[model samples]
Target: MRSYLIIGMCVIFLIQYFLKLQWLEYTVVTLSLLAFLGSTLKADKFPRWLGIIMMTAGLLIEWNKDTGIEGISEGIFLILPLLSLITLSPLLSIPLRLGGYFNSISVLLRNLLLHPKKLYAGISGTLFLLTPILNLGSVRIINEFLEELKLPSALSAKGYIVGFATAVMWSPYFASVSLVLLYLNIPYKDYIIYGIGFSLLSLVIGNVLFAIWEKRHPLTKEAGVKVPLEKQHQKQLVKLVFFVILLIGSCLVIEHITNWSMIVIVCLVSIIIPLIFGIVSKRWYELIPRLVDFRDRTVSMLNNEIMLFMSAGMLAFAMKGTAAANGVSDFLTTLAHQSVLLFAIAVMVIVLCITYIGIHQIAAVGALAMQLNAVELGISNISLALLLLLTWSISTALSPFSGLNLMVSRIAGVSGVQTGLRYNGLHLFIIAVIGIGVISVIG
Candidate 1:
């Protein structure tokens, strides 16, 4: 029953976004929150309670403010990322499993192991490159490899965080990009170009900082042998590489021609590419049943994301009609007037500070990027967006409370604080400065 309900929401969201149906979108958004609220009531421990608090605050604030039909309709689209991921997740898992991509990763790692001197750089670079293709799936693969080697968790956690965080900073398919595009209302292609440039800058700085850390605290024990990717996997690996590129290229072209959002475009291409691949390779018959079997668990995986995003939307809209909104806007405007460059730097620090206190970066970013009104920031919207994305990715990476941080810590077998902050804090700060510089240069 939960499986069906989850699947139902996924379908509604795709339909709602694709058709641009305001009424239906809000209907689905409302339903999704209610369903999640029901589940939260039953299981109050862990991060589940965070969503409940957000949802409750959203409700009370919205009740007083009354964001009518239109505001309600607009807020509904904020869940686009959740819905897009759901549609893409099952479709994506099929290729990672059946296509050579999964095994190809092991092959790549094996090669990295051969060049032991460059191993950290190689692993970090590989993760940054593969994250858009694999998302958290990359973490699973890395974790499996790390666990087999009996490497200490703390050693690899910072590298993993850097790799994955860079992916979120720039990828068109990442939720951060989707949210940025949603509010900025700009061509994703423009942001993609800027994002790529800044992301590279951040990576270069992060890797150098990481190398320094490695020098200061060398690995205590040897990383034992890893099995290399074999010939059979190599044959499929080429095919996997070709298709992943083709998939991304096709989505960009289709978006250009149709003027659809990246989320919508990705959802469409993710489904189409694999379907065609499965059929042409004569694997559709086998693949379809396995994908169907996996649906139950795959759909259930969205619990936290759906809850936070939907409630955040409501919270954002409700804030618009509150005095607190004006106060925040005024403060930001005054700060911006003082210095856009300094303001950008301050934004990064504030995001990290707030994250330390347990506020989700998404909540703060959505508020900053979406709700702040009438601030004479003297920064180009694109520059502002780059600043926001930089802070969002870096803060989330360093925040122990963030989903990404917790998952990485769990998989790497380190405490979240150790991995998320103790190890990566200064590295992330340097990256933040680089990110601001990149934005300033572009502006």
Candidate 2:
């Protein structure tokens, strides 16, 4: 029931984008409200309870100011695109899984890299490049391959976690990037150069750090897996790479021509590319059944995200022009006076602290972004976005309660806290410092 409501909201959003009908807009909000009702009770305890509290506070504040119900409606509508992205992006995984794309690539790589160090670098490098396209599916694919190896859990965890988490700094497909872009109202093209540059810098730094860590904790002789690689798997790997490049190029061209929001464009492309591929590859017979399976299983899994984002939207709207919002601006402005670097650091620290306590980083970012005045802070919208993106990327690796770390912990056979704080903590700090310097220079 909840899945249908959420999926219906996404469909209406896509329609409303093209039609620009006021009636459809209201219908989207109505569906959103119904979905929220289910999520508030069904979502995880932390976000579910936190969302309720935030929503209640937002409503009270709006009512007190006499903006009444209309203001509340507008607030919920503000983040509808983000909610749509979360619900729809999972559709990409369907084709990749059914087509055996990741499995083929992982198997081919496993057979080719027989040395432990070579395999480590190969896995990390592949994951870093593919994560922008595959998202968390990239990590799961690599982790499954690693489990068959005689490698230590710590080594494998470090390799994939850093490799996968760093891409969010710039990947347009990442929810973090989308959230920052929406909050700042900065175009993707304006932000892409810095995002890509900083991400490559972070990747280089990660590789160097991983090498250093590897030297101390060396792998045993049995770490290598020698198996005959199939020709078909190699062909599939090449096709997968070509398709990823094509998908990105297509997205850029369409965004330029249509001037649509990146979120909408990505949602459209994600759906279209797979269908086209299925037909072109003569796999059309399996596509509908796979999509139906995804609809039933995956759409229902977004309960926590749905509740948190909708509630965060309400709070962001209610706080606008309020005294509380002004206080946040004033605080950030004072930090800017000292040094813009300090302001960046302060923002990252606040996000880190909030996420460390088990709350998702999106809520922290959504709440603070409403109060951030770019002009007063003496930074362009693009610069602030880069800083926020860095924060989001770093927090994902450091926060034990984060879905990324939790997933890695489960696969790596270690404590969740160890995955974040013990293994990746110091390395993330170094990357954060370097990232801040790059943002300051570019800003």
Encode model 1's per-residue lDDT on 1-443: one tens digit a residue: 66566666667777876687767877676666565765564443655777667767866776666666555555555655545564465566676677646666666665665343356675677677667766776777777765666554655786688888887777776777777667777677777777877677766776787667667767664555656667776776667666656766776788788898778777666666668778788887878876776666665565666666666656665666478777776777788777677777777776778776666666677777765432366677888888888888887788888877888888777887888778788878777777777666655
lDDT of each: 0.69, 0.79
The number of clashing residue pairs in model 2 is: 0
Residue pairs with clashing backbones, model 2: none
- Model 2 spans > 4 angstroms off: 112-114, 148-151, 223-225
User: What does the lDDT read for residue 380 in candidate 2?
Assistant: 78
Give the lowest summed-lDDT range of ten residues in model 1.
110-119
Give lDDT tens digits, candidate 2, residues 1-443.
77888889999989998999988988998999999988877798877887888778877887887887677767777778888877777677767777787778677667745565666667777877788876786887776776666457777678777888878887777888887887787778777888878777777777777778768877666545466668888788877777767767787788788888888888888788778868788886788887887688778878877877787677767777788677767888898877889999999998899888876676677767666868888877877888888898888888887878878888788887888878878778898898788768766
- Give RMSD (Å) of candidate 2 vs. truth: 2.3
In order of appearance, the predictions have TM-scores of 0.90, 0.92
